[model samples]
Target: MKRQHSHLTPHHPLSGAETTAAEIVSGVDLTGRRAVVTGGASGVGVETARALASAGAEVTLAVRDTGAGARTTEDITATTGNQGGRVAHLDLADQDSVAAFVSAWEGALHILVNNAGVMASPELRTPEGWELQFATNHLGHFALALGLGPALARDGGARVVAVSSSAHHRSGVVFEDIHFRRRAYEPWSADGQSKTANVLFAVEAAKRRAADGVTVNALMPGGIRTDLQRHVSDAELARLRARAAGGAELEWKTPEHAPDPEAAALLWQDSQDTLAAKG
Candidate 1:
């Protein structure tokens, strides 16, 4: 498909310039931006929201719980001194909730981050009768985007950031087995397929949204300690932790040693720039 060459999708820009998150958004203002981040209450997602808000964006986090959600909002407000942060109830696996969110929301969206996903869990399904992983990870985002497409499109230059994984390289869309039908399933394979779909979702979305200034790009957030590993076994976690601490001689960045949220904030800034240019 890369050979088609019929259209242009944004590419990853060179990163040697050392523009950190805090730097890129330092003076930039997003005071009125209606930004929504799925899974923005924890880990890198929380960091992303903090950076955006620090830069003056009105950020909202879509999460699954109310207690933790309220606390996250309070913490972010305390940290950023910006109380625009709100917690919305949204389960990617539930299209009805997404519909509700879009209906209740009435405004142009500056940014939408499809960052919430399950890494590994016993196989599950949504109320819509779709597999839990692909349904929540891809189709849910897809539905949300489609539902919000018009509102976001009104601005003539909105952006969507689909947080993809390097695991995308591990598998393509298991088209036939998307729901794991006619085949026995392995948890990792499901995770791999979901990640690949994240990438392809951008590929497909950019192709369609490029002319309208809605740019979608996927990136590897390296590896951060998040609840994404709730399904990971204790043995697996210990082994990975050992390896992450120089025991595995791994070259990838880890949450502890990786650059801070300030480090990644610039990438999002450039992404906003790229989206504006594309339109």
Candidate 2:
């Protein structure tokens, strides 16, 4: 029997919440391709790097801790038997660090996974007075992508994957009070806005870089127990689980509700201006 859903966009046959990274990349040879995975030292980032390396791609772990990155690189190489895995320092919260990492890169980049991110941390601000979550999650990745734009476009057909989250449904970018200067801080709202920014970035970048064949996309890497939940209290976690068990469906924002070219453009400009001012 054939299922019919002509009104909906079809999902990939292999995609599911339980699908592992290895299964997805199986039999796909990436020999000679170069890949970068930020926050590759832990969580889904590690799995992403491993899968890329297993397929014969030269995988670089871009992490804040060089020691952890080196260890992860070693583990991935040992497990995959792909000796091309290496580590590079990348502190997403710091502009200088991002610039240094970008400047140090050489040759064309085939794949870039902006997989590193923070979630639901207490009210914190960067040295430049920007909200911590917004600065690291959105602005940093934005700067890194802009810096690597040429490298990605060099040979054309490069891919940039932004690992966003379902949390984006909680809120959109509050442009007027992006830094939480005037408004009171709430961890989840700040995190949600950053995640929303990630999606908006992919939307705008894909359109802008279409001429250069640099593809960009954002995805929600379904719920997994990860260190990303470090900031969530035990009580909050239990409450979330209870709600889920009660059959409360999340009000997911559809693609039609999300793509705002004007908002994307404004974010791009604002990001550039913010970076310029901070630098």
Candidate 3:
């Protein structure tokens, strides 16, 4: 009922349908917004797609797999009463996939939700030699945004929500050795580097496009047991799920508890624009 930028999203409990960020946007009508979500077939991505379609926004799910996306798209249509959901092939690991996706997209764009990410996994690199986490989590989205700069600009204003992480505070961006060329690579170290890149990318993009109406903001998705941790061992997951003070160890939110993917589109609406997505 009330909106305050200073008041952070509360996490004690979810009462009504709007309790979560995605749920809060369930009632919102994004009848004209066009959105793209990466790695959106499972976990928080599902909730993200559901909320946007529920709000009437045309959603393009960029995934590495299409079969899995069919299931996700069906669930979205079932919940939203809209068929604006479509799946587009995207392998953040491949530059060709990124390039092809950008080349084919047409019309006025409204929102870009950089929700795709790779978590603590083994060290690897893309074809171009960029580190895995930094590549998929940061560079891929960076390229996608820059590629679609025209669409975002043509619309006059657009919203770019970069889903960063609390892990960012663990370490800042490693400018000189982003690829850890000089150090032995660790899983969490890569994850932290990727998260830090998320924030830095957002801050830089926001500054560059502020005059063009592309207001970028980064926020932590809070702790949730999403498939992003599938690479984690069973024992590691058990520890994270364990409760310490007679309750949950992390006070973590469920997939539903994570911020709704559509909230950005709704909250940015103002008296001046007929559009739902604002830069």
Top TM-score prediction, candidate number:
2
lDDT of 1: 0.71
- Which lDDT values do the candidates have, in the order given? 0.71, 0.86, 0.71
Mark the 10 consecutive residues where model 2 has the least summed lDDT: 2-11
Residues 129-245, candidate 2: write the lDDT tens digits. 989999999999999999999999999889999888867766678888888999999898888889888888887899999999999988888777788899998898887677667
TM-score versus the correct structure, for each prediction: 0.79, 0.91, 0.78
Give the local distance difference test score of model 2: 0.86
| Displacement of the residue 213 alpha carbon in candidate 2, Å | 0.9
Candidate 2, which segments miss by more than 4 Å at Cα? 1-14, 247-256
Per-residue lDDT of model 1, residues 1-279, tens digit only: 221101112235445335555775777888888899888877778888888888888888988775677888888899889979888988888777877888887888889989999986788876545678877887778778878888778887788988877555444555445678777876776776677666666766776788888987776676667888889988977876677566453432222221222223322243234234433
Give the distance in Å from residue 56's predicted Cα in candidate 1 to where it truly belongs. Answer: 0.3
Flag the better candidate by TM-score, 1 or 2. Answer: 2
How do all the candidates rank in terms of lDDT, highest first?
2, 1, 3
Please give the ranking of all candidate structures by TM-score, highest first, separated by commas: 2, 1, 3
| TM-score between candidate 1 and the true structure | 0.79
Off by over 4 Å in 1: 1-20, 238-279
